[model samples]
Target: MSSGLIDTKPLAGIALASAGYACFSMQDALVKWMIATYEVPQILFMRSLVIVVISGVLMRVRHHPSILKSPYRGTVVLRAALMLIAWLLYYNAARSLGLAELTTLYFSAPIITVFLSILVLKEAVGAGRWIACIGGFAGVVIAANPSHSPHLIPAAMCLVAGFCWAWSTILIRLVSRSESTLTQMFATSLLFGLACAVSFPWIWRTPDAEGWMLMIGLGLIATLGQFLLYEGFRYAPASALAPVEYTGLIWAFAYGYAIWAEIPAWNVFLGALLIVASSMVLVLWERRSEISARNRAAA
Candidate 1:
């Protein structure tokens, strides 16, 4: 009974992580579907509004109203503003690039997160992980190939999105030290929604029936995706969740081909796989080292 219970924990974590990635993949597909018909600001506003409403209700019910309170109000506001920029840049990248390319570039988040944690959060990162980060970025270069004439705009947009995301990740880590993830998340949604709402007047056009459905789908899936991601983190260590996140690539490939008829090239796939594999190994290494250190201290 004890052995079975122990084995079950990791399995459950794996399932939760995979489910989270699936939800996120669906959200990306819905966003891509709407990009053709909806203005970026309109889509951002509606989707963020939906998330704020839903997450607010959840927080109220969970007796986690403190999630709305933050010790670092100014930092939280700046973080939310950065998130707004990140989302806008990311939406533009998705609009201009193929789904596969956008998704692949987004995976660079974990790598960026590590570097930011080391520099800003003062985490002790070793030399090996730094080498892995370098390799991961090299893979991004191979995948993006910005020097190529045709891929220039999308490539540049992806880089901007990545940089913005790196900043947001650093801000989130800082906020998480003093505030709940729920607080940070809800604040971000509220701020982003407001930004979107303000921009809507300038860019608003009435969405068609198809557009409405797509936007609704985008909001719903994104909300669910974020919920699952938070839940998975609650249940599992980050190392356990990292591998499952790669499943997003499979979903990206399927959705891109089925919906937009956009197929990734050989080099893109190779580079994406290299980055994912390296990141996963780095995560496993970190987790094992942590576990060993804990055991030694206990001993």
Candidate 2:
């Protein structure tokens, strides 16, 4: 019974992580569609308004009125700031880059997260995991193919966004150890909303009806994705949930091809395969190590 419970939690976490990635991919697609007609700041401002409302409702539902009362306010605020910058870079890149390519590049966040975990949390990574990280990075390089002349700027933006995302993920992992998920959500919405508002004066644009709907949808979807993502961490270790995030690549491919008629180059698929394989290997290694430790404890 205990073992069943143990297995269930991580499985649930993986499911949530996969679902979160899907939601995020959908949100990205919406952002890409809208960015063609609107500025990034306008989208950010409108979407952030939606997130603030949704997050507030979520906090109320959880009976946590004091959403800002987190022990790790500084860390949470910093994380939100990193995410805001990452979002700006990613949305800008999405304006020109194919979705599949941008996603593959951004998925490099997992590799960056692993290294950040070591540096920030002082977590020890085994040699095998280190090798897996290298493999994943190599895949990113292959997928990105900096040698490609025209994509240089967008690719650089994606890399920088991925690095910022990695830092944000590490902060989320750290803060989640002691902070409430609702608090985290609230902080993100509040801080990011404020940031967007400050930029709104400079880049404000009136949206059409269709644009408003898309902006609202983007915010709501992103809020749900953020909730599921943080909840996944609550249920499972970061190592266990990390690989499930690769599912976003599948969604990205579908959305790219269907919506924009954008098909990635062959090397993109090859690199994506490597990234996914390395991530899976890391997940399996962590699961095995966890089970082994549990068995040793029982013995």
Candidate 3:
């Protein structure tokens, strides 16, 4: 991700992404719970409406009554649309796919983001960062323990979802440069609500009291998740934070085990080690880069 220009606070960005991903993993869990009872559009419409109301109020209070018309308004809208597509593909696939399998396929997003960062954002990705990305995905594959005979269609959908998410990550970096966090967030939520509202009437199954709780809970979690993630792109380059997305796998497995009593295998331990090491590598790399820049400035 680039705000047209990437500043080099990789460590901070990584931290924010790490925290943000934990929230995302939780969001996925919440969606998985309601997918059986609710259509994607219904869930998204409700969730987005919550975010819109919350962010809109905060936007007015924090800034002004007027929406800050970003020059990247088009890009912001595109990002929001991409995320909606991602949720649709991902949640639909979740109906047929196991959690581990679904996440394994979607984990491809980081590598895609890294490549896209180099290609789209024109960021100088170091060999270390590439190694970190590879190592982290290797960890995810090990930890995921994807089924051997996963349905091809759902698997493909997961990959497409990952790609959509990767594209949105780039957009976050670009838009964050010009748009305030609240403005971009409000814009995204508003668009998401409107788009999902289209089919919401047709698919509407009135959420019962329990359903209402879960949906509102989903919206709150998503609001925090989106905020932290968008703020992350501000602190670090998209390429730099890409590997940190792998940390979500750690949270994902944790949630699975906690919720479903899925015991961890040997591979989980092995994979977690690699993922942690890969993060360390990125940290060291960023540290070195920062020092070098300082030295160059002094010289």
Candidate 4:
């Protein structure tokens, strides 16, 4: 029940963040598989159903009825809608894109988060953070290599998805000030599930046994990943946890290779290196800034 900004457990946050990204990587892989045969809305509806059930159970187990209530209901609904849009775009892109490539593009979220924080939260970002953000996007451009006409649509989708996700992250941080993590998760699940369900009449299709299992796995993994991510933010500053998300590149590459025999081009590796390094610089800078502020207060 610690608020996202007030908690100061960086190590635990990093660990949770890393684990959450790993789960997300896996979920993306499954979604990639499922989307080949199923509609995006269908996949979303089923996966969100699983999330609602699991998150509801967790809320009940925690015996926190407040987890079902939120003072910021409007923001919660907006965040959930943004998440749903982001997922739809990402998954649609995933259906055609290499996992690593898609992930590299989506990794733009952290950078976008920085700028959004500046604009929305009025968080004063230093020159170093700005440089890091520029460098990170430069890396994304290099990795994306959008010159290839065929990749343009999917790449653009990923970029927009990253933007939406960044906004969702900001909202989560804002709402976490007064909302329980469970409330955040539950509301997001319920809202997104309902949204997707509204499309079920047009998108619904019978799934084979294999499809059923994969869809269920997708739900479970995504729910857990999102929960862990929310918890990670609760334990540490988002900047400190940003770099840990780069670990998903490794998972994406591994899953891409193992599942689809897909290997990223050399530019992807290079771009990933730049992006990860830049993001880490921002994280380190933020950590130092936090330390300096604490010391100044103590003095």
CA lDDT, every prediction? Answer: 0.65, 0.74, 0.86, 0.77
Candidate 4's residue-wise lDDT over 1-299, tens digit each? 54336555555666778789989988877876777689988888888889888878877887755643557788988999899989989888876786446756888887778778777866666766676667766776676576534488888998899999889887877787777777788878888888888887787899989988899989889888988988887766554454465667667767888998988899878877886787677667767876887899899
Taking all chains together, each candidate's TM-score versus the true structure is: 0.77, 0.83, 0.94, 0.85
Tell me how far the alpha carbon of residue 230 in candidate 3 is from the true structure, in angstroms, after superposition. 0.7
- The best candidate in terms of lDDT: 3
Q: What is the lDDT of residue 97 in candidate 2?
A: 83
What C-alpha root-mean-square deviation, in Å, does candidate 4 show against the real structure?
A: 2.9
Best by TM-score: 3
Full-model lDDT, candidate 2:
0.74
Better of 3 and 4 by lDDT: 3
lDDT of 2 by residue, 1-299 (tens): 01011322555666777789889989878887887788887777777777778777766776763634656778888998999989999888876786446766787887777777778877666765776667766776666565534388888998899999888877877787776676678778788878877876677888889888899888889888988888777666554555566667667766888888978788878877887887677667766776787899899
Residues 1-299 of candidate 3: C-alpha lDDT, one tens digit per residue: 22233455767778888888999888888887898888999999888988888888887777633344567878978988899999899999988988678878999999999999988899999988999999999998887777676899999999999999999999988877767777778889899889998995589999899999999998999899888888888888888899999988888778878887877889888898899999999999989998998899999
Output the lDDT of residue 159, model 1. Answer: 67
lDDT, candidate 2, at 109: 85
Error of 4 at 76 (Å): 0.6
- Regions of candidate 3 where Cα sits further than 4 Å from its true position: 1-8, 64-68
Model 4 residue 294 lDDT score = 87
- lDDT ranking from best to worst? 3, 4, 2, 1
